[model samples]
Target: MKSRQIVLGILKSGPQTGYDITQLFQTSFAFFFDSSAGMVYPALRKLEKDGMVTKEIVPQQGKPDKNVFSITPAGEAEFAEYLHSPVEAESVKSDFLARLMFGEFVDPERIVQIVKDEIQQESEEIEQLQQRLSDYLPSHNRCMSTGQKLAFAYGINSSKTEIAFLKQWLQEHPDGK
Candidate 1:
């Protein structure tokens, strides 16, 4: 989905500053969507220009004025339309996978090291996801929707599965041939 749609979806929850929106992307949306201030500010400007959102300047003591954004009726309609739209195909852009595809050209030792590094990285990701799930799932801190919980489960499970596959492959090919 486009960044504008994502921004609208976030605004649907409530009005927020651009900084708040960016934080949500970094925390809540990090697993499934990649966004940055560079992307979000522009989308916010465009959405404002298109009448999908409204921006209000809020002055702060000892800080810069904050631009708070709120979704307009048009933005809600757009987000609803997005929700009804057909799901896009999953896009996988993995540097490790690309490197492995050309493994034959690289030294065998390098490939072994690469696979090991990937396993470590995936393990770290699984840990972080588990921790976030724990922090989010409590009744007092239930910020994530059921759908988000499911997505986190999928991410953790997939990372575990990938690590298992990599370990088994290493075991089967002890020589890294």
Candidate 2:
């Protein structure tokens, strides 16, 4: 998803400064996507120019003035249009799968370590996603479209299955041999 669209949605909820928006992306949106100030500031500027969103300067003590932005009516309309648009298919480029495909070239020890770490990471994510899904279930926020909801489920299952595969591999190679 485009950074601007994500930022716009956040703004739609309420007004937020650039810093606040970046922090939100880091914490709440971290699971799905991420953005740095480099990308966010530029997008905010572009959104301002495009009249999709508006920014106001607010003075802050011991820091520079903050640019607080919120989505305009035009921005909301544009976002709704994007919602109706077809989603671009995600590209699959897995380095782990590549290593597994050419397993002979990889050291057995490193392969085991990689699989162990990968499985652990995915397992934690799956657990967190399960919690998030439960929390989001009661919310009336129709902002999460069907596509996004579907992807979220896919992400949970994908992580779970990946962990399952890695665990099976570990069982098969008890000594990492």
Candidate 3:
């Protein structure tokens, strides 16, 4: 989804400051979406300019005033329109895969090292997601919707599959052995 639409959907839950939205992306939606602070701030500016969302300057003590954003009626309508639109296929972008594509030119030992590193990285990521799910999911999973649980499962499983593939590829190559 476009950053603007993502912001709008987030706002539907309630008003949130830019920092709050960023944290939400990091904690809640990181499994599926790659939202950065850079993407979010610009999208918020554009949404304000388009009159799709309104911002309130909330005063604070010993700190800067926060810009809290809320979706306008138009924003809700726009988000609904996007929901009704056809879903797009996800485009995969992997630098590791690109490197492996041209592995013939690289040293064989280097390829083995790369595969090992990737397996370690994916393992760490899966651990982090599992920790987050355990920490945040209330009531031992009673509070989580089926789709929310499924998204986490997808991330965990995808990382596991990638690690397994990398390990198997490295074993088959076995040039460093």
TM-score of every prediction relative to native: 0.91, 0.75, 0.87
TM-score leaderboard ranking: 1, 3, 2
Best by lDDT: 1
**Which of candidates 1 and 2 reaches a greater lDDT?**
1
How high is the lDDT of residue 91 in model 3?
Answer: 77
- What does candidate 1's lDDT look like per residue over 1-177, in tens digits? 988899999899889989888877776677778777678899999999999999999999999998999999999999999999999998988999999999999899899999999999999989888876776567325477787778898988999999999999999987789
* Candidate 1 off by > 4 Å: 134-143
Question: What lDDT score goes with residue 155 in model 1?
Answer: 89
Model 1's lDDT to the true fold? 0.88
Give the Cα lDDT of each candidate: 0.88, 0.80, 0.86
Model 1, residue 95: what's the lDDT? Answer: 98
116 in model 1: Cα distance from truth in Å? 0.6
Lowest lDDT sum, 10 consecutive residues, model 3, at 136-145
Q: Candidate 2, after superposition: displacement of residue 127 in Å?
A: 6.2
Q: Write the per-residue lDDT of candidate 3 for residues 10-60, one digit (tens) a residue.
A: 898789999988876887678678777777899899999999999999999
Q: Rank the candidates by lDDT, best first.
A: 1, 3, 2
